[model samples]
Target: MEADMSAGDLDRRVQFRRVTRMNTALGQEETWADLGSPVWASRRDVSDGEKAAAGGVFSTVSARFQIRSSTFSRGITAKDMLTCDGREWEIVGIKEIGRRDRIEITATARTDR
Candidate 1:
């Protein structure tokens, strides 16, 4: 039988569309245009290590890619921040962590996409 898609459902079976991005401070809110592709993962709480990269040297250190819904809200267990159009924004929380509502994502200070 075929299964359908659900919100926040990480289906390892079908390989969900995980969009990884290198978060950072841009001076304002973020947008899909600013977000990188393939979903770069955060190096984690640690300061150094390998993660993921998009449009740069493959050897470049990877950035963080926390969950972000197009709609902004609060309640997500993990704290987040975002940047878009070169502006920085704090992730208050997630109103809905669906791809439809998700948009902005914050990164560590001075980080680049």
Candidate 2:
């Protein structure tokens, strides 16, 4: 089960992307955007629930995936996000089930770059 990371701290975590119907003129799909973060986020933040709360540019579509969090601290971190080999994410915000509840992985999309 995903853990809640609200009271702890929202730091860099994993990134995810989903396919959108929209693509570049060349038909090439742009899944990520440059929002001062190097991690290439997918279409959906998997756990990204609300929009207004996590203010940022986002794609119309999203997807679901699995990831692991820190065991010592026993939680997820942006540094745990992997793209191909191993990548880090700039956690925009964390969606907590409740106070001190297990935090699930959610993210917001930036502009395609």
Candidate 3:
């Protein structure tokens, strides 16, 4: 199905950065590179999952972002990060809308702390 992304639908502006891993002498280091300009998107909290494991409880908050595909290239993948409202989120999943007209990004942030 196609996503209806009218001007009023996109109420938030978010920036996307591609995550690149470089192998250093010590270990693998991740670097964030700006993909393009900030794009208008509709953001919402998708779900929150928590579980008691080992010593403490593990919790994660998943968020969803809907953006026009034209705003970005097809290079965006799960190895990217989204910055919204001064918070950094790691992209966990991505869904392309019909005909690549829009994209739905599912990201998560640790909330255990």
Candidate 4:
């Protein structure tokens, strides 16, 4: 557990969302839907990197979020996305702290979609 981090440290509110696939007149379309209510979390910048593709360079920013563990948070996975401050992040890693007392999520800024 993060003994030094108190609930007050979780100053930011973030929401989790998952992709929902639906059949359309043309074909299947994927949309995002909220997974649960917003939760308090501490956000911290992790890293910044660049990717090159198709003769272009794209910048990527990664961040880590720490939140108290709960039924809603426990269901979060790499397939889910988190949004805060009007920005969307792609979940990359999840680590349980002290037997699920807390969860640390590593995410990268979404640029592809």
Candidate 5:
């Protein structure tokens, strides 16, 4: 038996995109193309990690998104990106729950280089 998803759990709308790479004569090009329509997902802050070594200090903001399994397919991977609340997040990890009933995506905010 599988658990049902609560409507209240999915409150935020997020857009998913797959990263596409193309090889050209000059070099490689990458683009983000929409995978499908926007879907409702539950968002939460997972963790905050910091590292201070011999080099400069580094910090990471991690977040999790729970969505219907049907919303995303196997094509979605760590190279993908999610857009929510006018911000873009890079997908770092993905986990399938309860026989693909739902999916949990771990991501970090996309920072400008």
Candidate 6:
């Protein structure tokens, strides 16, 4: 789906974050660090699905975020995660729209931390 990226639709503030792993004496410690200042984005819930694993069903929610293209947004990758409204979304894909006018981020809701 194409996002119009209108000003009103970009109503939510989202922050991009990356995970940093450090090797410690005992083990590896991973931490999430902010990439840049929060930016306005248009967030939409795309779909929800259930995954069956280990004799259980797990629910996952997918979402799409549209943000204006910039230096920071252009550098984003699938390894990055987005935080919005106190929820973390794992980035699944990144696509540039219309000569880099905007970027569409596809992500899945992460409840396992």
Q: Write the per-residue lDDT of candidate 6 for residues 19-98, one digit (tens) a residue.
A: 99989998999999999899999988989888888998778889999999998899999999999989888899999888
Candidate 3 deviates by what RMSD? 2.8
- Superposed model 3: Cα runs more than 4 Å off: 1-3, 21-29, 51-58
Clashes counted in candidate 5 amount to 0
Candidate 5 deviation (Cα RMSD): 3.3
lDDT per residue for candidate 3 within 48-69, as digits (tens), equals 9997879888888899898888
Ranking by TM-score: 4, 6, 3, 5, 2, 1
The candidate with the higher TM-score, 2 or 3, is 3
Screening candidate 4 with a backbone cut-off below 3 angstroms (N, C-alpha, C), the clashing residue pairs are none
Ranking by lDDT: 4, 6, 3, 5, 2, 1
lDDT of 2: 0.36
Candidate 1, residue 26: Cα displacement in angstroms equals 28
The list of candidate 5 runs beyond 4 A from truth reads 1-3, 21-28, 49-60, 110-113
- Candidate 5, residue 78: the lDDT equals 84
Per-model CA lDDT versus the true structure = 0.32, 0.36, 0.83, 0.90, 0.82, 0.89
For residues 1-113, write the lDDT of model 4, one tens digit per residue: 34756988999999999999999999999999998889999999978888998998888889999999888888899999999888899999999888778899999995544
TM-score of 1: 0.21
User: For candidate 3, which ten residues in a row score worst on lDDT?
Assistant: 68-77
Model 6 spans > 4 angstroms off:
1-4, 110-113
Model 1 agreement with the true structure over 4-101: per-residue lDDT tens digits: 33344421111012223556685444433322332222222223343354854322222333433422223222343444334343333223325443
Best by TM-score: 4
